[model samples]
Every structure is written in structure tokens, then in C-alpha cells.
Target: MEQRVDRVEQRQDRLEDIVATMGELLIETREMVVEMRRENRQTRRIWIAIARKQELFDDDEFQDVFGDE
Candidate 1:
């Protein structure tokens, strides 16, 4: 019947909408994970730089900042 066809079409439309929203969410999550990884790498580089400079500082200030390096 025509009514049954209409119902099926509506259901399909709703499913398509859900799929689109899920796809958008997946893309956003991937971007956020990538950004976090980049930030972590940058932080590691900064720590390495600080450690390399440790010999320049006197014992007390270095210990205060870097905790008994």
C-alpha cells in the first residue's frame, strides 16, 4: 500500500541522517586525537631542552624546578 511505502521511506531518511551525524562525529574525534598527539610531542621536546640546560643552573634552583635532577 502507499501508506506502507511512505513509512519505509521515512525510516530510511532517518537512518541516513543518523549515519551522517555519526560520520561527522568520527571525523571530529580523529582530529582531536591528532591534535593531542602533536601537543604531547611538543611537550616532550620542551622537557628535553630543559634537561639539556640543567648544567647551566646552580644546584638549588635546578633542584627546585626539576626536582633533584
Candidate 2:
């Protein structure tokens, strides 16, 4: 009976450890997701700027500003 109790305690300790580790991993994953979203926003802004530049190049007034590239 005592050995059975001891085995149960050991299993409980291991389960607790697993849960704690999983919690830590969850937090890290959340932080990484936020960082990725920030990077995605920065990339989107760069794309928008590039598109605007392309539109300007197609405009007739482009020559008035830069005077022939």
C-alpha cells in the first residue's frame, strides 16, 4: 500500500512539472505571435510605400518634380 502511494505521488509530481513547462511554452508562443504581427505590419507599410512610388512613376507630373530620371 505504501509503495502504491509513493508511485502515485511521483506521477503527480511529474504531471505538475509537465503542466508548468507547458504554461511557459504557451507564454513564449504568445510573445512570438505578437512580434510576428508587428513585423507583418512593418512589411505591409513597406509594400504600401513601394506601390505609391510605382504609381508616381506612372504619373505625368513625375517629370515635373524630378525632371527626367
Candidate 3:
């Protein structure tokens, strides 16, 4: 019975460690996602500016709106 209890405690400790590692990974993944979104926004802005310059999008209203991005 004592050995069984010890084994249970060891398993519980290992489970706790795994949970903590998963939490850290979740936080890192969230940070990476945020960074990627920011990069995508910047890339979109550059593309729009290029298109405007090339006159592919020749609406003054669109120019006014995307100019702020």
C-alpha cells in the first residue's frame, strides 16, 4: 500500500510539471501570433501603397482611407 501511494505521488508531480510546461508554451505561442499579425498588417500596408502608386487602385477615397494604414 505504501509503494502504491509513493507511485501515485510521483505521477502527480510529473503531471504538474507537464502542465506547467504546456502553460509556458501557450504563452509563447500567443506572443508569436501577436507578432505575426503585426507583421501581416505592415506587409498589407506596403502592398496597398505600392498598388496606389501604380494606379491599380485609382480611387481617391481608397487612397485617403489606406493612406492612414
TM-score of each: 0.68, 0.79, 0.83
Question: lDDT of all predictions, in order shown?
Answer: 0.83, 0.81, 0.88
Candidate 2 residue 13 Cα shift, in angstroms, is 0.3
lDDT of candidate 2 at residue 55, scale 0 to 100? 85
lDDT of candidate model 1 versus the reference: 0.83
Predicted candidate 1 versus true structure: per-residue lDDT over 1-69, tens digit per residue: 999999999999999999999999999999999999999989866885676676656677666765743
Q: Which has the better lDDT: candidate 2, or candidate 3?
A: 3
Best by TM-score: 3
Compared with the true structure, what per-residue lDDT tens digits does model 2 show for residues 1-69? Answer: 999999999999999999999999999999999999999989867765675678856556655554534
Indicate the TM-score of model 1.
0.68
* Candidate 1 weakest ten by summed lDDT: 60-69
> Which candidate order results from sorting by lDDT in descending order?
3, 1, 2
RMSD of each: 4.5, 8.5, 2.6
Question: Model 3: how far is 68 from its true place, Å?
Answer: 9.0
Candidate no. 2 TM-score: 0.79
Each prediction's number of clashing residue pairs: 0, 0, 0
Candidate 3's residue-wise lDDT over 1-69, tens digit each? 999999999999999999999999999999999999999999998888788788775577676767655
Top lDDT model:
3
